[model samples]
Target: MQVYLVGGAVRDTLLHHPVVERDYVVVGATVKDMLDRGFRQVGKDFPVFLHPKTGEEYALARTERKAGQGYTGFVCEAGADVTLEEDLQRRDLTINAMAQDADGTIIDPYKGQQDLEARLLRHVSDAFVEDPLRVLRVARFAARYHQYGFDIAPQTLSLMRSISESGELAALSPERVWKETSRALMEPHPQVFFTVLRRAHAMQDWFAELEALWGVPNPARWHPEIDTGVHTMMVLEQSARLNATLPVRYAALVHDLGKGLTPPQHWPSHRGHEKSGLKAIKAFSDRLKVPNECRDLALLVGEFHTHVHKALQLKPATVLKVLNRCDAWRKPQRFEELLLACTADARGRTGFEQTPYPQAAFFRRALSAAAAVDVQQIIADGHQGKAIRDKLEQARIAAIAALNDAD
Candidate 1:
């Protein structure tokens, strides 16, 4: 049996990137052959085994035939006769289809190395369109390599657009969609993920709220970009630059959905957009079955981002209200994430990218001062039951008021 390192390990090595994991494609190997060698079988649809020593995966060289719909609708063919080239042909992208043998000799039946050098994302074969998941995968690769100036090839982009229009993306499960989207959000250039999907007209299939924002107008004074979608992209990019977490990046992406619901007459002024956005956020989050952490942050940013932007002007009571609404005392980290998301949004506008946002520090200080109120002292002073709760509120309000005065 011949074993060759394949997929991401080979591709990352060629790009001078650190390889995090290694997988192998074994040609001329049978299930019995692998089992006899003490490789533990793990794959349900096809032959895949964990190495007896290194614990890395070794999948038998195989080919697939499209048998039904979506990504999982495929019949696998693996045997001792299957060639490494045949297995490579079934992959999604040329950049990921190359392999390396045990002797470190690179195998390039599909010219994946050439495409990688050109900073291009090209499909491996016509079989690329068989799996709808490839569309998301290609978009994710675009996000991953965007800093290296990588772009999807025109022909491959055409295929992505065709796939988007074929009703196949809709067949994907919500969990699978969220898995791709959340991973994309964590990428260094998360905005590229949505940009690629938008270019292919695929956003409407899964993110209709975001898609609707593309042509929608925003106040040019506040958002120099004018387009809500452009503003959202800038926000996502800024969030990444700030090293924000997945939930923060996601909040930055969806915080402006309310602006899309503005009436035509309202034009640049979305007077009650903060409240309006809650419905859109809920619907979008529910559709994707987004985690509570992400959904809650998105909801908080949507409802109170404006309040955060006006931090310097809000009364001490108003500042306390915002803190309470964010549940800052209970989940301080989440509250910090919300502030980062808002900062990203504020700076996302053109001409505002590098501007300092003291509002973030102001609110953070407000939360700190309010949380520092001496609740134990209030209880020790004979405050009890409803009186204790009232005294706590009074003490926190006084503390926040002192903070405002000090500022």
Candidate 2:
């Protein structure tokens, strides 16, 4: 059986983007042959193998059958026994299903090449809904593919809406959902996720709390972006342009998540929405299969936002005391995350503070100023805690704030 490169590697190569992962499909190969060749056998429900030489993944051409519902409903029989074309039919997206032969000729039985040329995202087969998990994949795909200006097929989007209403989406594992959402959030522009899911009516169910931000009013004079939802979209979009990682992007996307969940008041009373949002984010973290670092980061960002509003009113020492309690301020990177979130929040206004990003570098200056405070410094060294605290007293307020302006 001849093996060929497939999926993202091929798509990225075509797009001239950096290719990160490599997956392949083996045509005319069988499970026995793969095992005989020293490949590790995996996927009980779905057959797949790992190459011993490259340690890269290699799957044989096979088809799936619907045994239940959601993403796990089907089973696969892969190996040299199946044709290369058969494997392409099973992939989630057209752009991902296309294969490249050893000679560099693309083997696209599903017209994925055409779709790629047209900058469109299409499904491989009618069984697109055999597992509702694909709907999330599609939405995630839209989020990334938007950089290429692609559109989801109308019929495909209709299927996603139907699948969500059927409650099959609930059957999906939180980890899988989180995995997909996390990847999508990494895209340069994630609002495509909103555009597709919103049009398909799937957003209301998948992330109902966020849907509340759809038409929420902004202070207008400060926020032209309007409600918490529109601001969320802007936050996610701007995140792509920043020097942040996956966790920071996610925190930014959901930084104001609690604003919509706030109790209705004559005016938007974010009261304890920050704390409330933390609780919500934790539950969401559990569902999205977010890593501990990301979850903790998100929790800290939400918790920090809850307390940040009080920053302008507190003395730097008292502010330092409060900031010291947080794990975020413990790391320089995490500190930047808080600053980014605040900047994103500040940018949701109509005027100076209400744009998509901060103006005059306010958050950066605040972060630089915060860095001067010694509360997070190594306190005790070899000495005991109280002694360290006493020794640190020699450094006064004026002394520390001076360091902030030095740079």
Candidate 3:
């Protein structure tokens, strides 16, 4: 069977980008033929096989037809008869539709190379609108390659807007949406992902909490950006610059959901947004089936970010209370992530992009001081049960007090 390298490997190579994985499309291979050739069948929905020697994925050249709705509503057709051009036509983007033969000859029936050279992210065909997931995928691609000056083709963007307005986005599973969103969050310019979704009118369907923030006002004294949505995007961008983890980035993303609930009459002043954000964060986490790590960090940042910002003025007991509420001593890594999220939030406002965050250092030092309290010494002094607990708290409080005094 004739085999050709396909999809991401080909596309990334053309852009002089690193190829993470190599996928092959067997142009003339049947499922039975692959099975007889020692390739193990792996895909449940389609004829995908693992190469016996290389162990890389080798999917038979296939074409799909719209069968219903959402991403899964498709009938895939694959066989020895499917042509490379036909298989390429089914891809979501023109840049990803190109393939390469064994002799390294580039196949460009859809002119993917031309689009690549033009720095345009154009869809392969009218069939692009058939899958709702393509909207997120395109947005994600924009986020990933925006640094390279890539922009979506106007026609493709119009199609994305159409897909968003067609009510099909509602059929997409939460898991699928989060999958794209989480990946997008880790990109260099994650803000573009949300911006593209908003442009397509798709944010309300999946990210209503975030969409609600677009017009919401915050105090210009603190947030010159004023728009809560703009602040959120800036926080996300700062989190990326800090090389934060997924949980930290996700926390920064949802940290200001409470601002969206502020009464318009209170204009520019959201007094209790920190705690008010918990409900919205929980709803988002539950709806998306977000992992516990991500949800926990998001909740901490949502409910206590203001406390971190006001740390210098808070009493030692109050600071200790904040630490205990976040379980900082027990889960030190998560606590650090919370601090990063808070730092991102502080730096996200207008004219604050490069501002130093001394609050983060203060919190870290306070945590270290409190965490260093000698619990074993209290136990050794015959303190037990309630007495030992009381002594430990007193020692931790003393340590935090010492830290504050030193500062």
TM of each candidate vs. truth? 0.98, 0.83, 0.98
Off by over 4 Å in 2: 204-206, 268-272, 306-314, 327-329, 348-407
lDDT of 1 by residue, 1-407 (tens): 99999999999999988788999999999999999999999999999999999899999999999999998899999999999899999999998999998789999999999999999999999888899988899999999989889999999999999999999999998999999999999999999999999888788778999888887888887888999999999999999999999999999999999998998888888899999999999999999999999999999999999999999999888888898888899999999999999999999999999999999999988898899888899989998999998888888888888977786
Q: Encode model 3's per-residue lDDT on 245-356: one tens digit a residue.
A: 9999999999999999999998788999988989999998888889899999999999999999998888888888989999987898999999999999999999999999
* Superior by lDDT: candidate 1 or candidate 2: 1
Which of the two, 1 or 2, has more TM-score? 1
lDDT of 2 by residue, 279-391 (tens): 77876666667788787777777777645644544454554554455633457677666667656555534453434443224334544565554654645345466765654
Model 1 — TM-score against the truth? 0.98
Provide the global lDDT of candidate 3 against the true structure.
Answer: 0.93
lDDT of 1 at 208: 96
Residue 28 of model 1, lDDT score = 98
Model 3, which residues run further than 4 Å from truth?
none
Clashing pairs in 1: none
| Candidate 2 similarity to native, TM-score | 0.83
